[model samples]
Target: MILSIGCSEPLTTREKGAVYGTLGGAGLGAIIGSATGNAGAGAGIGAAVGLLGGALIGDQMQQRQNQDAAVQRQLSTQQAEIERQQRELEQLRRQQAR
Candidate 1:
């Protein structure tokens, strides 16, 4: 199953995080539950909690990436505008000198 995921198209950050969380949580939960005699329940609860936590973290990270991209784009636009203004200013200066 994990192999298939790796071979297939890359998953979004959220999905990758959730998968890692669920796998890690379930393994840990099972070990703990086995010592306490409730492995099944423990694994289920752990997986759910892990999924939620991982999803939230992944979502926040994704949002940050999007914001960064937007900022980069805005910066690029501002730079172009600045360059354009500089060119116009030079043109005006040359006209005044003439």
Candidate 2:
């Protein structure tokens, strides 16, 4: 139902950041850990580090997204104004013919 869909909450910026950090950290950690003969420790450390790094990155990404959205909104408004003016101009031309 629409209500159920509406109730489904989106992940917070922090949550997304943490998740990304975990995945990225895990991958990097495993690679480094394997190369160094400490895969277990490497993965653990990587996850921890990644979580922190991801949180920071995610926060920044969210901010950028917000800024981009604002810009898009402004552009849309300007486009609408231009369209309105064009319509008005056409209307005036039609009136002058009468």
Task: Tell me the tens digit of each residue's lDDT in model 2 across 2-85.
Answer: 223454687767668878788789889999999999998999999999999988888888888899999999999999999999
Clashes of each: 0, 0
Candidate number of the best lDDT: 2
**Model 2 quality (TM-score):** 0.69
Q: List the lowest-lDDT window of 10 residues for candidate 1.
A: 1-10
lDDT of 1 by residue, 3-45 (tens): 4456657777777678778877887888888889999988988
TM-scores of all predicted structures: 0.77, 0.69
- State the lDDT at 46 in candidate 2: 97
What RMSD value applies to candidate 1?
Answer: 2.4
- Any idea how many clashes model 1 has? 0
